[model samples]
Target chain A: MAELVKVVVDAMGGDLAPVEPVKAAVEAVKERKDILVILTGQEEVIHSELKKYQDYPTDRIQVVNATEVIETAEPPVFAIRKKKDSSIVVGLKMVKEQKADAFVSSGSTGAVLVGGQVLVGRSKGVERPPLAPLIPTAKGVSLLIDCGANVDARPSHLVQFAKMGSIYMEHVVGIKNPRVAIVNNGAEEEKGNALVKETFPLLKEAEGINFIGSIEARDIPAGYADVIVCEAFVGNVILKLYEGVSSELIHKIKDGMMSTLKSKIGALLVKPALKQTLKSFDATEYGGAPLLGLKGLVVKTHGSAKAIEIKHAIFQCVQFKQQRINEKIAEKIQPAQFPAPDKE
Target chain B: MAELVKVVVDAMGGDLAPVEPVKAAVEAVKERKDILVILTGQEEVIHSELKKYQDYPTDRIQVVNATEVIETAEPPVFAIRKKKDSSIVVGLKMVKEQKADAFVSSGSTGAVLVGGQVLVGRSKGVERPPLAPLIPTAKGVSLLIDCGANVDARPSHLVQFAKMGSIYMEHVVGIKNPRVAIVNNGAEEEKGNALVKETFPLLKEAEGINFIGSIEARDIPAGYADVIVCEAFVGNVILKLYEGVSSELIHKIKDGMMSTLKSKIGALLVKPALKQTLKSFDATEYGGAPLLGLKGLVVKTHGSAKAIEIKHAIFQCVQFKQQRINEKIAEKIQPAQFPAPDKE
Candidate 1:
């Protein structure tokens, strides 16, 4: 590896914090020699757990002390301010200070959304920053944007969401000229709520992406569209429901397999393939969602996340580095009249 | 089987029409001896297809002639007004005349939503008839209400949606005292758009239902609650995402299995268990959304529905009959001196 890509992780956030995320961070170091992970939490507690993974390169694994932690219930502004040494706080600061190339957190979703905006700031010229998550589609995975990072979203915001989402899916996920769709109640362009109705025209007029007309939610799973776009509120529901339904179905499938002897035999035979398939569908494989439009990359994992999720998150930084997705996003949003970076 | 429940199907509607739906109806008849189907369409088309099913009960299968077919693109109001001999018009009339217990259609969603409201009308004391669909959940399934029938839904409408959705889940789906919740951005009772924030108190204060605060879309499949209530706009997105995610996962699983020899073996063993489990997750098994609050039962099937979907929709009528779901809904909403359905 040319130079180890550094990723700062919020070790205090998430339900299984420090332990699970720390485990993943160690696992990632073992798997990817080029990845240097800095665990940000209360230094004493984090180092105690780090002792379990002695094989991890001492030079590559460092612990940055963060004494405070933002709880799930605390208000974003209050938590980020009061907990100056919080995992999210110190982790975000690492990216802002160029001490880390990326920041990953399985913490307060509200805190992440706020801190990503207030601390890191949006890329120059971007009007609205969107939260984009890779959603499973028939064509593999499509990036769904605005899953509640912004509410009462405007047309321009959606257009920006489509563009930024498109870039991420193309560069990171490896889909070419992804088909972008504005989620709608109907397939017709004239259909959908006020936001979709206005955004339809702008998305059609957008230059950089493959703008597919309105996509109805029912057709969403039939592997219909590539990059599905919507406001944060709508996107949140789509993303959550998608995850919920996937897990529910998987559980039910396991239940059915255990229902009969013949099926049991068949299930045993297909266990490997089924497991592989389920893994691909697992969202954690892609790490956490990237709060796009930030100057530096800030990815948010679920607060209830465990160690494997953290490991995947650190690995994600490798791809983010390979792509320079942050720089591209900055250029696309701001289109520098003068090449500007690291400016206040 | 208690005397076969007869369902009047609007054969003239739907994309594949009398062929696919007829095939499905025939299959349904074979599967259940308690179903007597009345296929309404162009007499010639119905008989020609029926001839293929020699096992079809000659006395049980009745053909009701309706020559005009209403296309989805047509104006819903115009079709309801002008298409007197249209399949939808005839079917609604049959329900109105009590000749059929329920009318099933895979035609235009807009037309169905409108016709169900205008033709069937809302039951006494119902402010507005909402659409409710049973969506699969880990613990079984949850009903999503106002999934497209009311785009501009008010808080009071949603309050009614919660109560009515709870009742349907209890009586029809056989869930006991179903948990009802409004789909919102967060689980907090204070969260969501103006509609949710304002309407939550109403649902909370309302009697005769288990109002379990708010549920986020992601929590839905986790079976966090029994009745997932929201306006048509949000409901539409939830229902579609539910379908899309499942379909995408299934497709990915199928593709993943074919990737390698080892996986293929695993796929074979797990296929039966997967299928049995996957079937329960299929939205098609749940029939269609009922245009609730209507004076009569009007079921809307998937726009691209085939015969099996239609048969399932017809079966919904049987549950409606057995549970007296409507009567219960009416009683719950109109407690003798309840105010009008709208607090808007």
Candidate 2:
């Protein structure tokens, strides 16, 4: 029998709270029999939400009592330090203790980032772990590393991002020797801010990855590279802008379609096809960004994540565990003298 | 009547070169009489293209002979140094020598930035000159400062961008107060990179500008601020990603619309409304980015700028001059001992 991947989820995190997270856990266990979910939150709240689901298996899903909830606005480091029994902290501790294979959260990004590093810990030789998300592109999806963490990254940090992004895309996403490119203002080797200029040559010489040279931001949507490497500031801007532009475009398109009766009828006719096409560009369908280089997997989803997104994030951990991605990452990074986590 | 705004057009710059530049100059003179354009390029080629336009006022337009062209791939500093007879250099020289009120080019961005700082000179007290362009947003347009120039900008540089961008938006775009916001991953004052963290407090205390707090990229398109400030790296990424996402969405929309006869008919019916709505989002309709803080105006249009964009860029100088923007800029900048050019 295949080994069941036990995933710990922060049930009280995100805007939707235990409702979405708890419901998603039930759905996740139902959809995949080879997975077990540990929902961390106030047991009654989680149980109440789970009771709404009639057919989900009760055995595969369990709730761990966590009395505190971390709000989105709270300072991450301080919140994580003070709220020991918070869902986010409890969930991460489970992973740290090797009781859970992966930890998933739609909580405060700052809290998740800080808690993951501080509690769950870093894999050996990893310097400044980054959050890598799959962004939709015309061809398929590309991983944007350091999306919201490590804003002030060095050239060496970006090289690690590139290597980690390549590893994630290859094993989990199934792209072979993924094409890696550093984000810059222009495609030329010498054109970029100091970080990119320093990192470009290093990316070209880095082994085990296909360095495709610099990619202009304008070329990112065309899926020019499988792995897009950048400091967190650039990556965050791109990710947020991508969401903003997509929403604005969609809103504009709908407004245009509803302006007249003729176009309204046209909108009706084109609705299905347009929806299908836009579905391919939806980031939520692809799960959340994994804060790579951590000892145990820590995935951070949107704070507004719903049941489906949370469900997908839970399933993403299964594949991550089955593929033994952390081992691959440990190999990519240079050996450091830090104590390694005990193997299962 | 109104003081004639003497504008220099780089007739041999951009992909369309002498043809589009010459044609736009003719169109500008015909459309507005209070403007004189001095075209710089290989004179014979510009003249040949100019000859194609009939019934244009000949007296207001003049051509200067320049024998060289700066290709897009050439190193900017070297090109500015070696290609003194190039159109970019000649046009900039015209602005520097006070023969022209402004210099407009759809050439190599690097050469224009380098040439603008070296030839046109910076305003007194300006730390670094920034390229500010008005980007189309949901409500209206917002100025994006430091798009490509000053990539590794200091906190003081961003403060200047905010000040200059606010001035441009108020006078040229004609918005009052022109709320300025620094682009960041999060909207909080403390949530930013090292550069933004240092710039945030300075922006809050900056004089002569309306300072808003940090703006996330997602909020930028909603026209949350009239002036969006950031270092060139972040600005360029936002601008390019905006283009890339818009184009991809458009391409996908067209593909969806053409997938079947029903949607195709729908596409035909919705074409007019869609086209008009999309046109509003076009960046070229807003004209080129002005390399602000220069003693004389230096505007760098897209390399792919067409005749209409060129005409618009030339006419933009008219409003800039008529409004006495440079004098306002000079006053805003800290006083220096450099001799001010005599205002005609």
Task: Specify the highest-TM-score model's number.
Answer: 2
Q: Model 2: residues >4 Å from true position, as ranges?
A: A336-344, B335-344
Report the lDDT of model 2 for residue B309: 90
On the 0 to 100 scale, the lDDT of residue A191 in model 1 is 74
lDDT of each: 0.80, 0.89
Write one digit per residue (lDDT tens) for candidate 2, span B1-344: 79788999999889988778888899999999999999999989988888888898999999999999999899999999999999999889989999999999999999999999999898888888899888999988999998965688998788878888888889988999999999988877778899999999888877789997988999988889999999888898999999999999999999988988888888888888888888888998988989888888988888989889989988888888988888898777664355335546
lDDT (0-100) at residue B7 of candidate 2? 94
| Total backbone collisions, model 1 | 14
Tens digit per residue, CA lDDT, model 1, A1-344: 56889999888889898889889888888888898889999999998988887766678888898888888998887898778888898889888888888899989988888888888887887878888877655556678888754577778778888889888888887888888888888787667776677789878877788997988887776656678898877888888888777877777777877877766776666677668777867777667888888878888887777777778777777888868998887667644354325424
- The interface RMSD for candidate 2 is 0.9
Candidate 2, residue A97: Cα displacement in angstroms equals 0.4
Deviation from native of the Cα of residue A234 in model 1, angstroms? 1.9
Tens digit of per-residue lDDT, candidate 2, span A37-126? 999989988888887888878899988999999998898989999999999999999999999999999999999999999999999888
Model 1, B1-344: lDDT tens digits are 58667788877677778787788778778877777778888999888988888876577678889988889999888988998888888888887777877888999888888888787777887888887888877777788887864576777778788888887888777889888888888876656877778898888888888988889887898888888888787888887777677777777767777777866776676676667778777777778878877766889988778887888887778888767788888878864356647645
